[model samples]
Target chain A: MAESHAHTLDEVRAAKSRALAVFEPLAAVVGVGITRIGDGYGLKVNLREPPPSDTRLPTEVDGVPVRLEVVGQPRKQ
Target chain B: MQLDSARGLKRALIETVLTPFVSVGPQVKILAVPAGPVAGVSPVQPSIAVGIGRKAGHEFQIAVRCQRRELMTGKEVEQIRRKAKNEVDVRYIGPVSKRAAPWTQLRHRPLQIGISTGHVKVTAGTLGAFVRKRGGTDPHILSNNHVLANENRAKTGDAIIQAGTYDGGADPADRIAALAGMARLRKTEPNAVDAAIGKLDDALEFDPRTIRGLGKLAGLGAAFVDEGTEVAKLGRTTGLTRGRVTAFELDNVVVTFDIGPLRFDGQIEIEGADDGPFSRGGDSGSLIVEANTRLAVALLFAGTEAGGENDQGLTYANPLRSVLDALKVDLVAE
Candidate 1:
């Protein structure tokens, strides 16, 4: 089995921070998180709704792709 | 399943099914697993998880936490499984209840943190910790708002007792502080804390340095708790208990109070030591601190319980920094 190289937790966090800094001001952004992707890591930008085509979030940061995720009203539990 | 779609399904299930069941039977939690392991079986199917707690247990396994499996029959389990409609796998885990219960006949001295303190009108809860108003000489006692204020039922200068009203502390014999301030809790909004402070009486011989079990006062950790950070607490019900922070940065956690259901965000959840629970009722006010440095971290509040011999339960708390900031107080340091 081949070992897959992955971004360290710190690196993933930095990418997330950069993504949040850019998209957090947008009205659609609700929260941002870092999660493991196939072999590296990706930034998950939570949105209030599906992002429009003109959303400011980039395709990648620090070699990590940014994934747009939509969230809803908070759950009770 | 995608996280977005999974959350939507969770919302629907809770609104239509779990909420009604919980309203009738308070000892259950419905968990939605978009994808995860269950009882060592990693089923790819998006499942609805139900944890039915009976008696408290030593091992806090989430797969099936029943105190006595015999208490829950095979028929009842099948009935629940049948109702799922095959859209999701219904996973049932019966472990012990982690609810904290009130202490019985425990004696505590005055002016000590980690002892009982509650509104004169209600059962006793822990004193939690002590603090001072920023730039002020007066010392204040910290605890849950439910303890000191009786869930907003108490007014300014309401009497607070050392041993809690449940332990027979009344009037001049036990009164030690007066309610000062509290953070308002909202039902639907994201609340950061359930906290209050009491002004210690000038006449009482109070010592803010020593906790009942963990002696000497220390500073607090303002940073967020990472997963598996070692923590401990001293309380009236269980004296001293230790655990590890299982998870944090949690949002939308619904905790039931006597007033009603309130949702909290950015909360920390602790899994207790193998021997027993880290806290119980009457321990709600206990200060959760880092075990080694004694760095005050979280304020112990709610736990779930079942009728068992161990009486162990998982404990939830508000971050110490949030509590302090919300109440505009600072931890008293040596």
Candidate 2:
């Protein structure tokens, strides 16, 4: 059987089913360069190998633009 | 020797022996007209000579028989007319090169051979061998003139069996196309005769990227060689090889001796040093391509013959489009 990642789209909805307001980790955020080659996302992160956990706001970490989001979970330790 | 039947044709015959470029043939003829204008026929450019004899003979006898050709154009013909009273006749010029028509029609099947042990298989010699279509028929191989001519020994349909590569790669000659006209016994003046094409078949499929790059023929470019410009080729004896563009175009060749051939257009030669800058011996038929663009630029052609006789190991090549126009075919590998 093929192993499935709970991080799948369905799991995301289940995790936030009842949450009306919450904060989530800014996973990916990129910006647009003048040349605009590929889409410029404000931020991007790898859950498999997350960057050193941060507790900062409006961060410019790892060349990615970040902003806070609502997630109802405590940034999984 | 009589003034008419046996004139200086004997001496001219001797000169032809020394210079293959101008030889006497059965159809050879020369025309003589007074530098003075003729009354009826428009006085044409001084008399001309055509068709040279290959063997030794008297010069006087030869002057009477060859037709002279016009500048670069093999069309215009000037025939001999009795010289007017006391008027000196002018000498005529001959054709750029002598060639024989090919007998057998070309075979478009892929030529296969092993570059490692000269092994023979039923496939094109190796990968990267240009698989092209012949006159819109079967697929063929594209290489340099030096390669398929096999040092000028073989002709069209001469069954180019498999041979290993310059390294351990496949043999390039396997996929070579047989040339028709303009290629006979290899001449020397226009030093580079490097380009040659082959025909491929339907059964064989190839990756255009790996085989040959398809692009528009550059009408004009920097003309200067750009460093790091990638290039690739499929040679007759050497198979396929790649390199970087080294320098700018150099002309006005200061020829030292009669080294059989002169230009190194697609020879993959770089700056100065002679001795086939990169490929040697059988690598004569390969194509030179710019690295990323894969633009077919040069056609690999001649190198030094025996004795390293022409010590200037410089190789020669012909530009690519000339190859296409000369062969009257298109690059099917785009």
CAPRI tier for the interface of model 1: incorrect
Q: Say what the interface RMSD of candidate 1 is.
A: 11.8
The numbered model that scores best in DockQ is 1
Whole-model lDDT, model 2:
0.33
What DockQ does every candidate get? 0.06, 0.01
lDDT of 1 by residue, B28-53 (tens): 32221101111232222112344322
Docking class of 2: incorrect
- Residues A2-70 of candidate 2: C-alpha lDDT, one tens digit per residue: 222223223322322211112124332111011111232222111112234774433323233322222
Whole-model Cα lDDT of every candidate shown, in order = 0.63, 0.33
TM-score of chain A of each: 0.69, 0.24
- Candidate 2 per-residue lDDT, tens place, B196-225, comes to 444432365433434422343222122233
| True-vs-predicted CA distance for residue B49, candidate 1, Å | 40
**Full-model lDDT, candidate 1:** 0.63
Model 1, span A1-77: residue lDDT tens:
22445766677666665765677566455445544465665555545455666856566666766665443322111
